[model samples]
Target: MTPAIPLVLLGLLDAAFSGFRAYAGSDARIRKQRFATRAGLRGLAVGAALLLAPTLTAALLLVTGDQARTYNTLAAGGLGYLLPLTVYATAVLLSLAAYFALPFRASTLAVVVGLGPLTLLRPLAIAAACLGAVLNGGGGSALLVGTIAGAAVLCVEPTVHRRWYHHVQ
Candidate 1:
């Protein structure tokens, strides 16, 4: 199967989980319990890893090129590569921590704290970058699928959060 398949499946699963949480009508506290399980952590890890793969690969290319002098993929003399790598790497690490390391409610809160502001900006930019990559034959379908998945998450999460928090207060 293509690499995009996993990303697509995970994206769909992510959306499904968000939808489940929305319809489940559980309070934020209880919802955190549901989402912070071992299984849920694994899912979050996988999804986060997938989401960051393309940008990481790009950064790795830059590192490898510097070490081996084989090729440099960091277009625009590294400016293009550095920006996305730095931003995405930071976001991914925090997202992993928020979902995997932190406790349930705190994890949910952590994502809000970390990503709430950049929710629209980051996902949209990444989606646009991925589309550009696909059109320019830069990354691949997997990266495109991942960007789409990330965008889907950004779009749906606020509603999920609202649903989760609705009964809390």
Candidate 2:
């Protein structure tokens, strides 16, 4: 398994959770509970996938025994390598909090507070993808997948927020 696959998967997981959070927080009572449950399940799945990824990748490497000389494969695929995922998760959490705390509807402050970190991290997502590609022996496909995943986050998050805002308002 190339390194890009894991990174892209991680990116997609991050975006999925982020989008869920954005969409789930708008409702009240039973709807909120259902949304939260679904979102939590998604998060758990993502976490499990991330935890398994390194071991799976290592197993594949052992099977293939392809010497892709770049960096330490184990280290590259390890938990520490998921810093980008963690950062993205943090940004999503912060955005969700900000979205709740700040007033919606024509409020630039709310949007800025909610999206600032995500915007800042957009470039970092690309950088992480590039790094993952490099570490995985120049599989540009992984980078492309990661980039697309990040773009999905960028697009979906705001739309989720806006939709929820409109619904709530």
Over 49-82, each residue of candidate 2 has an lDDT whose tens digit, in order, gives: 4435434544555466555532344434433334
Residue 162's lDDT within candidate 1 is: 60
- Which has the greatest TM-score? 2
Q: Write the per-residue lDDT of candidate 1 for residues 7-124, one digit (tens) a residue.
A: 3444545644444444343444544555544333444444455446545654465465554341222232222322453465467557757777889998888767765554435555
TM-score, every prediction: 0.35, 0.42
lDDT minimum window of 10 residues, candidate 2? 70-79
As a whole number from 0 to 100, the lDDT of residue 77 in candidate 2 is: 40
How far out, in Å, is residue 75 in model 1? 20
Compare the candidates by lDDT and give the number of the best one.
Answer: 2
